[model samples]
Target: MASPRRRAAASPALAAFGRQFRRYRERAGLSQTRVAQRTGKTASFVSQIESGKKRCRREFVEIMDPELRAGGVLLGLYDDLNGDGQMGFPTWFDWPEIEIEADLLVTWQHTVVPGLLQIDGYARTFLSTDEAVLARLARQEILNRDVPAPTSLIALLSEHVLHHFVGSQKIMREQLEHVLAMSEVPHVTVQVVVNEDGMPAGNGGSFVLASMKDRSEVAYLETAVRGLTTDDPQDLAEIAHTLDKLRRNALPVGMSRSLIRKVMEEKWT
Candidate 1:
């Protein structure tokens, strides 16, 4: 017997595009085989593209543009995916592509819950805008992908994150429960930095350190208005050092969960 075909993991952006492509193809009343025939590829190939296992080729996009009547929508996505610089995602401010491809993700959040770890209600509370909410929800897909190697995430959250009420007490309670549940996932580790620890390292702001498949590293820093992603050796080293120090000061996993539960019960309740 042959082994089952491995499903491909997709970046948040690619996943969104795949969803759009599938929707447009279905709305056009075309089957995968028919689309494949039009594009001169196998049905399996078309399926892979639509499922985000394989990238949509430019030629295929050219054919699909007219077949699906997308009116350049498909081409625009193609350009963005290929990094041709013609189309950019205005709402997705963070480096989702790198985040999805990372083998290890270390995050430090001083205020709110990190986007990937947030529950819908928690996210919706602070996101406010529909576009921002959708973009954040889309980024969560990386945590749920089961194939192409699951990314390991270590999140060091300030204890204040547990006490900070975004929407309501109920929302905060549910958010804490969500985090406790997520920490149970094999690839995810959640730790808390207690307020008593004085000023933690990297108290400057929130940031993410992504260790990519190729052994390269990148750091993402967020500001009031925008985010910055850098692979500069010095920046990566500095951010990595800060993350290491923060992790050292954070509570152990079991204690963190206990703290979260305590906060949920005592404060949020």
Candidate 2:
């Protein structure tokens, strides 16, 4: 039997924690300031904690038990929220929302090409099951919706990804043709990282830097083991710097287009 596939969302646990906190507070008839004063914390801190805008500390959890009078229920809730938020998302399902709101999306694909730009057949091959096909199709809707499109969508794929076929030769050929067609989109830029050049990014792993509508950037990194999402400027800046170095080593846009064309020709022949 196939394992049930899952759609990813940020920790529903954190979301749950927020709901619980608000429910308990209102039930206790305690204003936000009352909770703060009782717990010896600031009103703003209490507000942020309840709203899931910030993480709770062990100290905060301890105070909540005595102040909320729920006999450690609130602390238990805090323990549930202790996990990394992205744990709620399935293996590679973390980037679509950021992509939806991106002003520009710069990606470096060390292994498979990022899913958004993959052809239908290639996506299906990577998934290899009906459930994943549905998930990928839903993700495709992010790009399809008539929302304001990203100002730029740059994809830098390793040459190895082009050389390998995820599915049958026919599917591969069709996929490559689809890629060529996608290259024609005015906002898209595709480049290949050839083996002829020394590795510039030095295998730090694959990552995406999405410049959001607010002009801030978020970064996502994925491996077979897990996925990580972060909007921290420092972390995103470092990843962006590495991707920049890799882009420098990648084939020029025109040459990369020719390479994709050549691969498609050889496949069809």
Candidate 3:
């Protein structure tokens, strides 16, 4: 039979978490079964978790923290890996961490510029609070990291998003200029999706998918009220399909850059 899959396949934080958990268990003179019983989980689940073949939530780590005498180390590791959700997203959301661990990130923006590529000026237009903008700027630091290799981004922004005015004219121009500058980065590709062929836009919603080293993907779906973050296989499949459709109708890299430049000069000016 094939071996079970590993959840912490390439996440450094996750790997470290599993390693530290094992040390704590061993130090406490407990077997996996004993630990599992204490934590109200099956022995197999504990085994899988310590072996890096399974994932756990912050709550699980919280349980393990006191039980294993880890104090707060386990909780800290969990926070480091899955993110603390300080980005105005759901508590269960793994966004910036997902972005950091992902080998490939695909974004479809129907209205605004993709967050990762947005300049401070354009981003402030959407964010009402200074704290929120600071959170966004902090996440952007991942784009600068080289240790785990930069995340390759394929941004498919709708053409209308470019034409629409956000904030002042100067801010809009600056944002597109930032977009163009970032597109020149080797790992980033910006594509403008022009619906000349009239393909349905999945109700003009925006979503992002991060493809990790283990080939598992996470999706964040944008809604009016609040964005939804999901890892459900079916939800990922549908979102992936929609992302593919948007990509198919997108302009080539060079042409997309050209179009962005044209719009910035003509409309923003």
Candidate 4:
């Protein structure tokens, strides 16, 4: 028999389950706070479960079933995790089915731009020498996709993010030019959160809010520790509120583009 599928698979399934469960919960009008109270779990525990950073216990699923009332789906996922080894998403994380059909992606970059939209040089600078190769190979695959959706990306970059040059000044200059070039893509909207604005973004950490099919939204957050994925309505709502604030504090699109060009000129010279 095929070796039992690894726990890496379980993690993603559980993660997906949390996402869908939250959607259904919102549809059924149950708040996350309410779910936490009913399940006797902390809100952070609930968040971690939804984000797939923590393994959700089977008993908790059963307890949450009628409370969230998902017709037994989330409980079923918990049962599925019983036999596993090496839990967590593998490197080859396929886009969640929902994210593949996203209508818009609003993202903030405190240190660097998101990989999906990064230039090869920029991506390399952000990653370690070991990770850079793998990331480049992945980008090549993404670019090769035949029916890649007309992805709409609203990218916000911090002024400090640009100034903190990762690679050599030469590479950094090229990367800035690359960013300016990406701005010309019809579906890309680029903005810079200048330091003078004095707004604190990325304080809660880096996150991406993607608008998916049927108006579904997914949030992705990353820290020094790990990557987090969630489609929970409550979590998404909170993240969206934070992102909206960042956007308001960010420089206007034209100004950001000009700033990028100016940076390129200054550095390239």
Badly placed stretches (over 4 Å) of model 3 are 1-52, 55-90
Clashes of 2: 0
Residues 1-269 of candidate 2: C-alpha lDDT, one tens digit per residue = 22222322223334346557777788878888987887788889778766545656668668666666778877766654455543132332336656665678888887776787776778887677888877776765555556565457788888777778677888777777777787788878899887664545638888887765545556678767877776554665577567657767788888999998898797654
- What would the TM-scores of all predictions be? 0.65, 0.66, 0.72, 0.62
Ranking, lDDT, top scorer first = 1, 3, 2, 4
lDDT of 3 by residue, 1-28 (tens): 2232244343333444566788898998
Angstrom error at residue 204, model 2 = 2.0
Q: Is candidate 1 or candidate 4 better by lDDT?
A: 1
Indicate the TM-score of model 2.
0.66
What lDDT tens digits, residue by residue, belong to model 4 across residues 45-102?
A: 7776775557777787788777776788766555544445433333223454434556
**How displaced is residue 239 in candidate 1, in Å?**
0.9
lDDT of 4: 0.67
Lowest lDDT sum, 10 consecutive residues, model 3, at 1-10
Residue 116, model 3, lDDT: 90
Q: Which sections of candidate 2 miss by over 4 Å?
A: 1-94, 200-202
Which number leads on lDDT? 1
